[model samples]
Target: MAGKETKKGRKTGLDEAAIRGLAEEAVFARGRAYRDEGAVSDVVRRGDTVTARVEGSETYRVTVRIDAGEVDDYACTCPYEWGGACKHVVATLLTLIEAPEEAQERPSLAVVIGSLDRDALARLLLRRAEIDPGLAGWIEAECAAAPGSDADPAPVAAQARAVLAGRYAERDYWDDYRPAGDPAELRDLVDKAVPRLEAGDGRGALGILEAVAEVFVEDWIETSGGYDDETLYPLFQDLGRMMAEAALMSDLDEDERASLADTMTDWDAALAEYGVEDSFALAVRALEIGWDPPALQAILNGEGGKDSGTWPPKGEADWTEGELTAVRLRVLDAAGRHDAYLHLARAAQAHAAAALMLVRLGRIEEAVAYARKAFGHPDDALALARALAEAGRAEESLAVAEAGLSFEPNESVSLRGAHSVVPLARWLREAATESGRADLALTAARAAFAGSLARADFEAARAVAGKTWTSVRRDLLKTLRAAERAPERTEILLDEGLVDEAVKDVGGAPGYAVPEAVLLRLMEAAQSSHSDWVIRVARSRADAIMDAGAAGDYAQAAEWLRRAALAHESAGLIDEWSATIEALIERHRRKYKLRPLLEALRF
Candidate 1:
C-alpha cells in the first residue's frame, strides 16, 4: 500500500479521483510513491496504449489503454494478486498522468504494420527470428493453428516448449527466485487467451491454460526452475483465475465440468509439492458448481436463501470466497441476472460492489440502506457515499461518510493508511460546512487531521474548530508528537509558528540535522523570541557537519553558521559569536572547505 512521500510533482492530467476509485487506497498511494521516485521509465505512448518499465524489485513491463485520456484497460508483468491495478500499472499510469511530457509519442502498431510492404515485413520477421531462436517455430505454430477452430492444445504446447527451451538455454544465472529468462514470457502466452474472452470461448482458453501450465509445472519438476521463491506465483494465480472465469462463462456439460474440476485438483496437488497449496481451488469450485447449487439458485430466486452460514456449503472467510464471488458477480451481471447478482454479493459480503451496482440500477435508497449496514471496509461506505454525493444526495452522503470514520481498519490508521481516510474526511468536512452542518464539518476536520498530518490538514481542522481550536490544537499536537515521521512533525510545528515546540523535541539533538530549509527558517522565525535555542541548535548543526569533515556539506554548514550568527546578534551575543567563529577556524585549519566558511562567518 501507499503513503505520502512529499507530493513533489504536478497534478496528473488523468482523473486522480477515477484512478483512486480503480485501485485500493493503499495501492493508489504506493503508486504515488513509485511515480514520485521516478520508477517509471522508457515511457512511450503509442496511440491509446502507453507502455513503460516500472523499476521495482525487478523491472516490470506495464501497458495501459488510454481511452479519451483516461485509463481503459491495463496490465502489469508483476506478481501482484490483490484486486485492482498492481503498483507497476499504477506507477505507469501515474507517469502518464503527472508527467505526460516524459512519455514520447510514437505511432500505433496498426499504423506501423499497415505501412509496411510484404517483403519488408518478411525481412523484419526474419531479423527478429534470427535474434530470438523460439520466434521462428512459435510463428510457424501460430500460423498453422486456425482461428475459430476446436480446442487444439498441441500448437500452444509446442510454443511453450520452444519458448522455455530458448529461455533455459539463454539463462545467464540461476537462483531460488531468478528463474530462467522471464516467467513473463509464459505469462504473455497466458495473455494470449484473454482475446478468447471476447467470444466467451472458454474452450479455446482451456486449451491454452492447459498447455502453458503443463510446460510450466514440468519445467519446475525437470530442472531447477525453482518456483520455490513464489517467482512463478503470479503466473499460476492468474492462470487459475482465468481458468475459473472460463469455466464460469463456458456452457460445459456435467461430464466436462467434472473433468475440469479434476484437472484443477490434480494441478493443486502437484503445486503443493513446491509449497503452493489450493492452487486451483477457485477453478475447481467454478467447474464443479456451474451456478446450479440448489441453495444458491433457491436464494437467487428469492426462495429463502438467507442461510449466510451455508452460502458455500457454508461460507469461507478467506480471499478465495471474495475472488469466487467476484467471478460470480461478473458472470451474473453479464447474463443480466441483476437480482441474482445482488443476492450473491450480499451473501458473500461484497457490499461495496453490490452497493455500486444498486446505485447504477437507480435503486438509490436501497443502495444507501445497504451501505449503512455494510461497514465491511472503508470501501463499503466509500462506494455508496461517493455515489450518493455524485447524485446530489448531500445529506445521505454525509451520513454514510460520517459512519465510515468509525470503520477505519488498523492497517490504514497510519498517516499513510489507504483508508481514503484523509480525502474522504476532507470531502465530508467541506460538504458539511457548505450544508451548514458546522458540527459535522468540525468532526470531519478533526478526522482529516488525524489521518494526514499535513500542514494543510492542520489548517483545515483549525478553520472548522470554531471556538474549540484551543482543545483541538492540543489533541492534534499530541498526534503529531507521537508520529514516526520526524520531518513532518517539525514542519507542522514550524508552520504553526510553534518555534519553541519545534526546537525542543525536533532540533534539540546534537547530530540530528533537521532539513536545512526547515532549520534555516526556524532560526529566522525564532531569532527574537527563542534566540538562545536557535543559537544552540543552529551552531550545533553547523558544528556537526564541519567536525565530521563533510566536504560536500560545507556550503550547508556555512549557511547554518550564518543563521546562528543572526540569532546570536539578536541576543546581543555578537562578540561571543565572533569568538566561536574564530575558534572554529583554528580547530579545523586543515579542512580546506571549512577554513573559508569559518573565516567568512566573522564580522
Candidate 2:
C-alpha cells in the first residue's frame, strides 16, 4: 500500500475498496482465500512497484505499479481472462492490504543498478544469461554495434528473430496484461530505438525500428490464450507510429523517403495478411508527404488558406495524418516549442488540444468558439467546460457543454469506463445546478440517468425533480426494468428494499446469469421470509458445480451449499438440507474432492 499522504486524496497505498475494485466478486473471494492461505510469498515493494510470486496452479510472477496510491498498471504471468485482475494479482493486492508486513522493502531497480559497477553489472548480466539462456541473444543484440546510414539491417533482423525464437520455449506467454498491453520480449529491443530518436539519430532509429518490427511481427509467437489484439498487436501499431516520428525527424532525400514508403507499404500488406488492417498507412504517409505540404505549411505559419484541407481542421485528423501530427506535437511540446505545438495541433486537427492551448493562452472566446466547432467527443467538451468554469466563464462553459452534447457525444471516460459513465452530462448537471439553472440541470441529469442507469444518477435525478418526482420515478423504474437492465436494476431494487420485485425478477432468471453479489445478497435478505427461494437458488448453484466434478470449484460450491443450509435452517427445513447434501454426496460419489465439502455443508 502506498502509505503516505498525497495531494491526490489517497489515504493509503491500498484499501479494501481499491483491491476489490481491481477484481470481480468471485475473483476477490478466490484471492482472499489465497491470501488467507498464504499463497502470496516473497513480496517486495520497490519504489511505486510491488512484485510478488503467487502460488496458483503454478507460481505466477506478478508486478503491480502503484501511482498516487492507486493501481496504475499491473501484470501477471497467468493465463486468466474475463476478470480485469487475475487471481494472482488479487491475491498479491490482498496481501498488500491485509498483510503489509509480508512485503519486504527493496531498493528501486534504478538504485540497485546504479550501485553496481561496470564489472559487477557484467557479472550480473552473465549470471542472468546463465540462468536464462534466452538472455544471451538479447545481450548480444543490446551490445551490437550501431550501424550508420548505408549499413545492412539484416544483422539486426536476424538477431531479433533468433532472440525471440530462442526465448519461446521459456516464454510460455503467461502474461496477459490485456488492456495494459502484454510485456512482449520485443519491448526491451523496441526501447533501444527511443534513445536513438531522442539523440536525433532518425535514420538509426528507423533502422532499429524497421528491423525489430519485421522480426517481431513475423517471428514473435504469442502462446497465451488471449487474442493478440490484447497483447503485442498494439505494439506493432506503436512501431508504425514510432517509425513515422523517426522518419519525420530524419533528413532523408525524396528517393529514400519513397523507398521507405514502399517498405512500409510492404509491411502493411504483411500485417493485413495477419488480420491487421492498414498498420503502416500512417508511417507510409509520413514518408510520402513528409508533413510539409504547401497548404499545411500555410496553416502552420498562422496564415489563412482556401485549401488548407478544411480550415480549423475540424480540429481533427486531416488527410495529412492526425496520429503523425500528434507525434510531432508531442516532440514540440516537450522541447518547449509552444508556438510550434499550437501550429501542429491545429494543423493536425487535434481540436481538443488546440482549444486547451488557447484557453491556457487566455483566449477563452477562441477556445470556446474553436471547441464548439470541432468538439471531438464528450470528453473534449467536458475538458473545455471545466476550464471555462475554472476561468469564471460559467455561462460560456454551460453553452459550450450544451453545444458539445448536441453532437450526441459518447460518455466521458471515467472509472466506470467510457461506455457506462456519462461524465459530461453529469458535470453539466452539477454546474448548471450550482448556477441555479434547475431546468438545465434537470435536462442534463435526465441524460445522465438515461445513459448510466446507475443508482446515483437515478437519485440525483429524483433529488432535482421537485414536483415531477412521482411520475419521473415511475418512468425511470419502468425503463430500468427492461430486459437489458437486469443487473443495474436488481442492485437498485435491493437498495430501495423492493425485495419482492427483485426476488421475482432474479428468481425467474438463471442463477448463473445474475450478478453474483446481487444473487448472494438476495439469498441473504430472503433467508427468513423467502427461505424457500434461497434454498432453491443456492442449491441450484452448488449442484451445478458438484454435478460437474469440478475439483477447483469445490470451495465455491461449498459456499453455495452453506448458503443453502442456512436457508434450510431458517425455513425449518434443516432435515431437508441434510437430505439434499446426502443426495449430492451419493450422486457425486466419484468426485472424491467434492464429497468432503458436501459432508461439511450437512449442518
Candidate 3:
C-alpha cells in the first residue's frame, strides 16, 4: 500500500501509508500521540537513501533514513524518545506525499546533455576539440555513438587544422586531409571554438582549451587553473568581466588594443548598470599589460569620476605613495629584487598582505626583522616562524612559534609552537648525554613528555617519539645510572628485550618470569592474529618442557592457553578456545606425569 499513488499531482515512491504505519507503531510504543497539526518539513534523497524530516508546530527536526523498500534507521533531534521514533518521520512522510517527482533520479551530466540536438552536438564537439585537442578523439567517439546521430564532421575538421598548423605529427595522414583552407582561418576558428568552454558548454570548452594548451606552453595550462574554469559557467557573466580585466595587462599596441579597451569600458559601464561594484584589480593586471597602475588607481579610488577635469592625471599622486611603494617592494622581491625587497620589507609593517608577500618572496631575514617589532600582529609572527621552520632554523622557529602562542593560547600559532617543543626537548637531551650529564638527560626526557602533553595531545608525543626514538632511548638509559626503581621504565626495558637488566632490576611481579608460551600467546593476541605456525610452535615447546617434568613450565603453558581462551572469547571464537584448552591440558598431563583433571569440554 505504501508503494501506491493516491493523487495525480502527488509524486511517486513507496506508500505514505506504510511509512506512517511504521512511524505510528514506533510512536505508540513510546507513549506519544501524533497531533493533527504535525507537518512534513523536507525530503532529501542521496543515492538510494532518502531522508525525510518531519516537524511539529514547535519546529522540531526529526530525520528518517529509508533505503530501497525498507526503513533502515530513524533519528529525531527532539526529546521524544527514551530511545524511540519522534514526529520527524511523520513530517518527512507528509512531505513525500506532496512532491513525488522530487524523489526521481538525481540531476547528472547525462540528463543535462541528453537534451541537446544534432546541430548542438556538432557545435559542442567542434568547440571542445579546438580548445583541447586531447579531447578531440573522445568527443568524436561520444558524438558518433550519441544515440542515433550521423555526420562525423569533427574529425575531418580536426585533421585539417593539424595539417594547416604545421603540427601534422602523423605525416602520412596529411595527404588524406589536405586543407583547402588558410592557416590563419583555421587558427581563428580554433580560437573562437575555445571560448565556448568559457560559456556554459563545458565539454566543448574543455576540448577547445585542451587543444590550445597542447599547442602552447605550460604557462597556459597552469595559469588556466587546469581547465577547472568550466565549472564556473553559472558565473559566466562575471567570468567575462574578470577575463576583460585580465586583458588590460596585455602588451598589445595602442591601435590594435583600442577596440578591446573600449569594449572593457562598455563592460564596466554595464556592470554599474547592474549596480555591481568592480573592485577586482588583480584580474585587470593579469589580463592587460603595460597598463599605468597610477592612472588605473586614480579612476578606481574615485579621484577621476565621469566629470573629472583630468582623465586619469599624468603626474600627481595616482595611488598613495605608501601603498604603491609597498606593492612594488613586494613585486620586486618576487622578481628577485633581494636588496630592494629587504629595504621595502621593513616599511611594510602595518600591511599584512605585503608582509605575507615578502615572506613568500624569500626575504626571510627581513620578514623576521618585522616579526620582532610587530609582535602585536599574530599573522606577522606566524609568517616569520613558518619562514624560519622552512629554512631549517629550528631554534629560531621554536622561539617565534612560542611568542605567537603566548599571544593567544588557542590560536593555530599555539599548535605550531607546541609542535616545536618535541624537537627542542630531543636536542637538549642529546646535548646532556654527549657531555655525560645522565641526570640532565633523564630530566630532559621527563620534561619533554610533560611539555608534549601540555602543548598538544598524545599523538604529538607519539610523533616526537617517532622523530627521536633512538635519542629518547639513549636518554632513558641514562636514568638507570641514578639507581631509581621505575616499573614504568622497566616495562620499556623488558619490551626492548633488555632481559638481563629486567631480571636484576624488576623482580616483583609474576609478570616478569612469564614463560615463552605465555609471551607468544600475548604477542599473537597483541597483533590481533591466531597463527597456526605460532600456535603449533608454542604447543611443541610446551610438550617438550612437559616431558621434562617441569611443573612450572606446564603451569605457564596452561596459563598461556587460558589467555588464548580470553582472546578467543572476545573474538566470539569460543569453539577454537575449547580445542586450545584440550591440547593445553594434555601437555600439562605429560609434564606432571598424571591424567588431566578435566575429561571433556564444550564451547
Best by TM-score: 2
Please provide TM-scores, in order, for all candidate models, with all chains considered together.
Answer: 0.61, 0.76, 0.27
Per-residue C-alpha lDDT of model 1 across residues 285-369, encoded as one tens digit per residue: 7887677777777767756634632345553445565577688777778677898888777666667777888888989898888
- Residue-level lDDT of model 2, residues 516-561, one tens digit each, is 7678887888788888888788878877776776676788888887
Error of 2 at 20 (Å): 3.8
- Whole-model lDDT, candidate 1? 0.74
Instruction: Rate residue 473 of model 2 by lDDT.
Output: 81
Worst 10 residues of 1 by lDDT: 1-10
Model 2, C-alpha of 457: deviation from truth (Å): 4.2
* Candidate 2 clash pair list: 1-13, 2-13, 315-349, 315-351, 316-349
lDDT of 3 by residue, 340-380 (tens): 44433333333344445556666766655656665544444
Q: Which RMSD values do the candidates have, in order?
A: 9.4, 6.3, 25.5
